[model samples]
Target: MIGQILINGLLNGFVYALVAVGLSLTWGVMDIVNFAHGEFLLWGMYAAFWIWSLVGLDPLISLPIIVVLIFALGVLTYLIVIRRVLKVSGLTALLATFGLSMVLKNLTQFFWTANYKNITNPLVSNKSFKVLGMYIRQDYVVAAVGALLLTMLVMAFMNKTKTGVAIKATSMNKQAAQLMGIDTSRIYAITFGLSGACVGAAAALMASFTPIYPEACALYSTLAFVIVALGGFGNIKGALYAGLIIGVAEALGGYLIGTSYKYLVVFLIYLIVIQIRPRGLFGW
Candidate 1:
């Protein structure tokens, strides 16, 4: 039972890592807290659902489409909302994102009616297979693997590519980067888009088993905030490790204590860690 729980926790940790990576990018790069991050995830799930429902495409098959669409959404958001407020105070950007979050949630509810829709008979089966004396869900395995691959891809991009280096440069010192001839505005838009892409991929992966609703990503978003903070702002490796720690803690907490108190355990661990290392595990 413990092994199974650990396996489950690890699988979930991978997905959580992906989600936090997205938030980390925007926060680290632009110093902007996107309160609408969860809503962006909600939209991705919706896009997958509508495509499957209307066009008979499986969530897995429609994954690329959903990702690209959400990437566009992120760019549009930066261009339309974030850019205008970039020169303003951080609080103004925060309020703007908060308002945007409200608008997005309401718009989703207005159109989808708060109904919990789901993909039926997805390409990835929802069955569990026994592995090394533990049962593992197939869909979850797929999601976990996808999340891991995507996270690695993001890390590689950051380390290997010219554009990615520019992004990092901008994140480290925007004024310096600007002086070096990097277009800070374009980089910001791209960062936002990349953020959305991460969540969009996560949404696609989760949509197979998760119920699609406006509030579906609510808990995820909240947890992501904790994950990003616990991991330290702008620390991708921190986010990844912190997510795994949270996932394990949540699983063990649920098993040892009660399901109702799982999140309590999560926060308690965060508090303890923060007291020990105020900047987080990987924060400099």
Candidate 2:
């Protein structure tokens, strides 16, 4: 039983890590906390759904397209809406994103009628394998592996590429990066796009098994924020580790204390961690 819970939690954690990494990146690079971040994931889900419905493309097959589309949307958002608030107060940026979130959610509900939808006949649907006396869903495994690979790719991009280095530099000190001849605006746009891509990939994986709805992003978004805070804001590694911890913790808590109190346990941990280490486990 314990092992089964661990496996389930770990798989869920990988997905959470993927979702939170984008939030970490944008926060690190632009110091902007996007309240609309979850909406990006929601849009990604919708994008995958439409592609599958219209073109008969599997979510896995359409993953790249979804990522690219979301990336473009992120860049456009940066150029159009976020750019104006770049120099404004953090509160203003927060409000802007919050408003964007509301707009996206309402628009989704308006068009989709708050309906819950899921992919039918997905490749990984209704498949499971037994391992060490525990049954593991194939969809969960695929999503976990995909999230892991994408997380590594993002880490490599940030650590190995020249553009990634410039992004890191900008995150460290925007004025210094500007003085060094780096175009901060472009970097910001790229970062937002990358973040969107991360969420896009996550959404695609999730759509394979999870039901989609107009407000589907709400819980995931809240959990992403909690993971970011638990891991430390602007820290990718921290987010990854924190995601796993929270995942396992929630699973265990759900099993031990009942599912109703699972999230209560998570929030309690978050509150305790915040009180003890406001900077988070790995926040600098």
Candidate 3:
């Protein structure tokens, strides 16, 4: 039971971390909270689904397309809409994004309806391995491994590259960095696009784990907010910790209290944690 719980928590946490990393990155550098972030993930899911279903490509193989499509959408929005919001107050920016979220959610429903769609990957149901006396699902393992690779790559990119350094500088102190000659606007745009790409990859992988639905991304949006809050606003490392904690809490709570009340348990714990630390467990 213990091993099973750990495995489940880790995989679920992996997805949560992947999705929230983008949010953290954007919040860190741009200070523009994007309520529309998950919609980009949802777009990626549909992108992967359509690519696979129409072109007969494997879901994994279509990841690039998913990333590109969502990245382009993000960049376009940055140039057209978010650019205007950058100079506005945080509340205005938040409202701008909230409007975007509503548009994307409703647009998806209009086109796709609320029916669930999935990429029929057999590895999920067909393959598994016993790990420390627990039968671990191969698909979840794939998701975990994929999430790890993506996270590592993002971290490495942020740590070693000049562009990455600029992003961090902006995140840490935008005004100081701007005075130092860094193009703050460029950094903001790059951050948005990259964050979108991260969530896009997450969405593609998430589709492999479960059925895709229009409202699924909407659900993930709330989860993303909880993750960012639990992890600490604008802190990727904190997001990681928060994701694992929430994942384990949910797993254990579902086991003990039934899945129906699972969300209540998550929120209650989140509230308790926030009370103890308003910024988050690892707010910078």
Go through the candidates in order and give each one's C-alpha lDDT: 0.92, 0.91, 0.82
Off by over 4 Å in 1: none
The estimated TM-scores of all candidates read: 0.98, 0.98, 0.94
Q: In candidate 2, list every pair of residues with a backbone clash.
A: none
**Backbone N/Cα/C clashes per model:** 0, 0, 0
Deviation in Å, model 3, residue 12 alpha carbon: 0.9
Query: Against the true structure, whose lDDT is highest?
Result: 1
Tens digits of per-residue lDDT, candidate 3, 1-284, equal: 96797679878888888888888887766777898998888888888788878987766777778877887888877888789977876498888888998998899989989888877863344367987788888777777788778877888888899999999898888899999999988988888888888888887777776678877777677887898888888777787777777787888788788978877888999999899999899985
Q: Quick one: RMSD of model 1?
A: 0.9
Q: Write the per-residue lDDT of candidate 1 for residues 1-284, one digit (tens) a residue.
A: 99999999999998998999999999877789999999999999999999999999988888899889989999999999999998986499999999999999999999999888989999989899998999999999999999889989998998899989999999999999999999999999999999999999999999989999888999999888889889998888889888899999999999999999999999998899889988888888
